[model samples]
Target: MELLERLFMGSPALWGGGVAHSVLILALVVALGIMLGKIRVAGVSLGVTGILFVGIAFGWYGMNVDGHLLHFLKEFGLILFVYSIGLQVGPGFFSSFRKGGVTLNKVAVLAVLLGVGTTVALYCLTGLPMTTLVGVMSGAVTNTPGLGAAQQAFSDLHAGAEAPDIATGYAVAYPLGVVGAILTLAALRYLLRVDTQREEREAGSGTDALKDLTTRRISVEVCNPAIEGMSIAQLRELALREFVISRICRAGGEPELAGADTKLHGGDRVLVVAAPRDIEALVALMGREAADTPLMRDRKMISRRILITKSELNGKQLADLKVRSTCGVTITRINRAGIDLVAAGSLQLQIGDRVTVVGPELSVAHAERLFGNSLRRLDHPNLIPIFIGIALGVVLGSISFWIPGVPQPVKLGLAGGPLVVAILIGRYGPHYKLVTYTTMSANLMLREVGIALFLAGVGLGAGEDFIPTLLAGGYVWIAYGAAITVVPLLLAGLWGRLRYKLNYYTLIGVLSGASTNPPALAYCSEQTQTDAPSVGYATVYPLSMFLRVLAAQLLILMFG
Candidate 1:
């Protein structure tokens, strides 16, 4: 304490140590974020390293932050990051809701509801307040928005009502949520033996594939025999015209911008982000052999949201918007107040309406300029249908509410309501497109950001109170966390078997425990030794993610 005081007590850093701590913590957080973004085992959001930093800081500093500032950081950062993801993934996500795809949708719906059902069942037994119980379950599903809806419901139930110790409960279990999600994935991997047999099986099928297909950036050397005498700047400008300079590698040299003024050496290599075609041009322009490094290709399309507000090209209609003409962009769909609006000829512009657009990278960038603004923003509209479905489901579940039940309503999550609905949709929705391409992106945006914000609220709200309460209860959270992971997993394993013909990959996807849908399809490919499951898996995941978010809210409400 004395040493600390001497170094920073009067160091002009803290308004009670605010400035210094903020800088340090923010930097620390950045490092941790980088690590998480860079590393994943199997298909897990294993952000344990980040969690540890937060946990250690929380333990030492009691997780202090100005409430308003913390809220702003958490909410805005989450929305920004997730909004981009939504825009990128929206169109594909929405297509999941269509006809001939209902079966996959059914599987996804069932898995999520099962998670919710387990939470409520456990909540009833413990007599825990509904909010915390619901929050934990929703977070487990990676759907924090549900917690938000639950909070709203709780407050609505009793004006100015202090929610039950949900924050505390979430704090105790979130780390476990991360771990469980990873374990679920690991279990899925182990159960299906994806790691051990993928290469061998593929080889047998005469399509040898690399397990580490995901991209990585690396430095390489390239020599231009013809351009050795040319100035570096000229080479740089030439390269820039065709390819993005990803990075540069020089002989005992410092890396700098590839400019028209820099001199080039025979052995100099300029790293670049470019397509194979661009790379060919770059080699030809350099007049020498160019080293090619590993390049990652995205199998899925990217998306973004264009908010149609007053600044959105001044009240243009869809066709009048000239969106495609302006940017080669396609209007996948539109959203208003959490409802999906199909792309139409006359859907006039309105402030705060989110238009989900899909196209190549350049096109998306152009659309954002003309439409993205300060007052409004784009988001995945997945929440709308799920929210509507859940609201309807819960109300319906409770319409014949019997007092002898789990608190208020019939427990549909435990049963097969969600899965059944998802499958029905996936199997039959070819014409329906419950989650269209645009809608998929919108859905991902909503679910990702909504859940993150809710979690931020929970972490901030519960962190301090959680530990103290846990000790008083003799630290029962450990057991509860264990139960949360185990029960749902077993259910998924069996359900996948009985419902989906018990294919190994489907089983693994069911068990992987995280919300990533692509893996299930991948897993199916691994097990059945075919690509057909990929289609089925893709069809269901977006729909599943949407339902998980929407249902989470109502489930939280029920538990609270």
Candidate 2:
């Protein structure tokens, strides 16, 4: 028993500063925290945030590691976490601002401003240190990236001195931050006497104009004289919208695959894949809906979903490929990151897209070769681009910009630099012949590991002061944090509902996204049981994340 105690708890080598000891502690913290996070109470779990608390407990119990190693792990982990997030959201970041998304983003912006304003006000009124307030604000919003950016900015300005209280403040306020958004949603529901079912039904009634543009497919018969003899390419131009001509059948002939060069004749039926909203124009221009078309069930023509694994084909437009003219096949739809887009001429192909190609079996086999459908290529992650992008990000982050009236030049810092670089790489890497495609599971693994390491380091660093500060009037931060979380959400939620007439699901999604709270988003998803909340969440999440990270840094630089 004495030997076991010394070996497990009192060994000099185990407690002393070393790389292996630090790694072992980090591994234990992450593993235990993940296991703890999986235990749900009342359908709510702490998720990965549990790592922070577990690390804190271990630290409080007197475990220690090399400070330099801990700092390095923390910063590197933050970089990985933000970079992976940027990659995930970059593809649709710009495109998310169409039509109704503009309003949703506006609401999100307002909430962010409100949160910053509240933090500033608390700093002034409560006489609390700006560092503490900034941490509390980040925790109130449940934005770990913001907390990271604030820490980076503080360190940059303060000559590498660690702010142990920052993470403590974040840890103290984080629990309510999760619950407050959900409670605000519930309060608003009761205060306004909302009818979720009716709002859901109304949302289903086609209030959004962009709904049909992405996820609908239909068949139309060709009868209009103007387009009777026009090629499919010309017809697409006249319609002024994106649609794919998958197959065409004449009155007396068997159905065959249609392509850009396929000419239309009167009394011919064609299978069109397009946005549901654009269907009306096509139907009016072409003819009427051809229900139960023989072409849909035609046995002679084959339809196949081909995975794109060719690096050279990345960012090439569908028209540029000329699959129709070369392989006698039409790509009706291209699925990227789980969203299906109509295969239009101008649509740029990504490395990981799954395209639906319709043609003869031989033609599809030929097209498959053209697309490089080798699954083996996708198994190997393109790590060169990731390292190159990170290098560029470090360079970019080190560059400083002078703002008018500021005492010091502002830098994007470690967190902001990597995030911005990753977003750009994810969005435009293909244009420059860079392969940015990562499997979903691979990206998730990178993100989880990064965040786990970062949080563990933070917890260990802050644990010593955490309990002391809480006993010394730090409990008041809960009120401050609650105010920060609930007030902006209430105002923004009301504005979205009253001004924009947003549905309940979408409004709650906006509130959750503005806060950057995944638990609240999950709660909204569970309650709605529809895609409306997800749509709003995805539309506003990218902008909100960027703004929160920037806002936290600005608060530290200007006030801290």
Candidate 3:
């Protein structure tokens, strides 16, 4: 340790090395970040590797010094990253909240509590010091973000103002964080084997509700035509008391959402949800030339269902089986590669294929009885709105960088400014595309590399003085890391069961931020039915992302 330390301290690299050692460390980390971004990932790899490289490189090639500047960058970068996350999550987050954010909150709170409690308890009992405690806490939460907060807390309490020896301490405890996270995930999946779709499955569909409840609908025609000349807001407000408009279809166009701001025209078909019998009564009042809202479209409604080619059902051509005759429904079209099938009797049904069916509303119910949860309708036209929202988010985030009053050299969040802006853009942007959901994957490796390098820088700069308590009290770190995993795993299991019996593997992903897995969710989603694994995944995943960034700093601060 002494020899290497001396050699790294600009002890001349046999040639003209001198001050170049420090520069080389920085370059290496930067190079690693570049390589990870360009070679490893196509996108979203920037923040992960870039941040990691910068973080770790500090420990390896840095000199122990007060890095006020670098500290500011780190702090600001993290905040920007967090703020962007908050913005992106804001829109749907509220929706999720209305549905059941309470359960999510409880689990998150428990996670942080487990981190803190484990550390404090272990510190008192094992005398493992605070640095390791921070690392353990970070590992348990799978929240790197909390690490910074915890570290700050520890430094304030024990080491006056000068931070602990972050080099050796961070290096040692980092492994613990990685290992601890891995173990907790493994244990949860092993014990619980959860799935969230069961309850939702029991909740009957809106179609059934439509049939059961007597619906009242009103229709109005306008010739004004702005987009047609009907004001969506006015029409909606006009009908607010009696009905909620469901959809509006123009001649030869996709149906527009009811509340869309298009003007009404003479032929525009407006569909409203209300009492089934009151249609004639409302129409009677507005008569003469105009009619009350009571017009049903004659076009056949499309049924949305997922059809997979299970080996048990292979080699059967559509014409041969007469699925319509046998199942009381007809296939509207098949969506194999793209384009829905309007006429596909001759097309053979292959394994792993999908089909869309349409038939009588009763036939749909009958089909379910025959096919089980195997078929459904592709009905939510609101998907377009999601994509629109995402685009807007990205624009907003990108423009923020160019905002007039914003600081020029500011680090937006994770990877300076631009990347943070991008994260927010995607996360917050209104129109969300499922394909673009993973758009950030390209920079994932870059972000990791940056963080590693930055850590190395910190380690190199802090040198060895960061470790006074560590030399004084050695066993504290082991206790801290050990307790982090134990407490969090217990809490996750308890919380998972209490909340919704969330699928075990997905819950692990939530707790640990292991989004890319060994086909856990996909396989499970296929096996059990319903995309319920994703609910558990998405519920806690956002928080986990922020936590992952902060956890790194906390480990360094507490254990260093």
Candidate 4:
């Protein structure tokens, strides 16, 4: 009863005494903040960021946590959050620059540079401490890692002396930063008088140009005498295009499953799977599209989706797997991270890939066994690679580089190092025999817990000065933050539209991604009924996140 009374009464010493009290306070903050975040006002909610404000509230009411514990939780949480993000974006990070992504990323980089320039200008104009302004910039851009990076830089410079409440400036600026991005997007739509439907239509069916491997099955009847005696492999070489011959039929016989060695004879019918753009050329080369081909009507041959879960197959090429030669099944397509890829012989297999195979039922079952289609095996997390990667990240973060004129050496710090390492591991891990596949739920769980713990620490640490700072001209930080948020978005939006004539949905998505604001992305998805926004967001997110974190630390190191 006495312990319950102490817990309820909120005794400052009791609350700050040990790990149990600190954990309890953190738990309550996260729980209550999550509850508060669920209450939407006009379709916009704080989401997980509500924890920051709730932590402030707890701090304002004199809730205390042990200092050492708070610091450890905050830093560890930040590492987890950033490392998870790196893994998520690493696979597509370099590929994001292909085709149309190049243009989208150009605009996104412009937005990032413009935001940095605006913050620098504000610092010079307002005479605000760079520490505070950097915090404001991080919040205004809705980048949490940037805030963490900035704070870490400051601590390194000051040697753990009384540090300014960086999170206070972030807390002040973050809410409107979200709303401001949404407003900027909406305002651009109205000002430009964009036709969303027409823009989407003109954007080439809203298909990702990089992964345009559409599963178009064109049944063609052979008529070209030039290719009468050629193998399917020779035909592929002649066509200079990647395609799968799923089924083939003789003039008077039932359809049979096709392999690389399948021969093309005059009047033979075959079903070819390739991109839409290549269908016409393939049809011309073969003969013509046969509407009544027995290939489509074949019941003996079937297509089955096999999930790749074998660790040994992480980097094996399809040619090495020899699905067709051994299992008598042809792989038609490989789906990775929601994008369909052409299943060429040179294509390397990865864990978690879903490959579509066309063959007889027995052949497909054989192929499935070869690929290890065990969900239980895939569900098991590879913790060794993760911990090893994290350890490497810490080592990388500790190594500092001396600049030509700077007084201090520059480091990637806790946030940037793990992020960069995680991306590399995620992208090239398979080649090195490291399987970095984590279920979406597992990744999300790690990310949420990490961010929540980090935010709770920041809020509690800054709570003492939050109200005081706000009352004393800190409200102007909102105006500064708004300027920081809205101006760069508008400028980038204009440049992307006028210079490149970018599709409206893609432009807004680039803007949202440049700001690193997911709430704005949700708004973009809601406003545009196409995946153009999502594609643009994904293309820019990794680079934008890297740039934002690096910029924050540089600003503190150079100017703070």
Name the better of 1 and 4 by lDDT: 4
Q: Residues 428-516, candidate 3, lDDT per residue (tens digit)?
A: 34233221121123233334443444444444444444344456654355555656655666676567656654434334534543222
Error of 1 at 492 (Å): 3.7
Worst 10 residues of 3 by lDDT: 203-212
- Reference-based lDDT, each prediction: 0.47, 0.85, 0.43, 0.85
lDDT of 1 by residue, 510-554 (tens): 344234433333444555554334444444555565455456545
Model 3: lDDT equals: 0.43
TM-score of 1: 0.48
lDDT (tens digit, per residue) of candidate 4 on 324-353: 779988888887655466788997777888
User: Sorted by TM-score, highest first, which candidate order results?
Assistant: 2, 4, 1, 3
All models, RMSD in angstroms: 16.9, 2.8, 16.0, 3.4
lDDT of 2 by residue, 372-485 (tens): 998889888889888888888888888999877767778888899988999899889888888998888888988998999899999988888888899999999999999999
Could you tell me how far off, in angstroms, the CA of residue 212 lies in candidate 4 after the best superposition?
6.6
Give all TM-scores, in the order shown.
0.48, 0.91, 0.47, 0.88
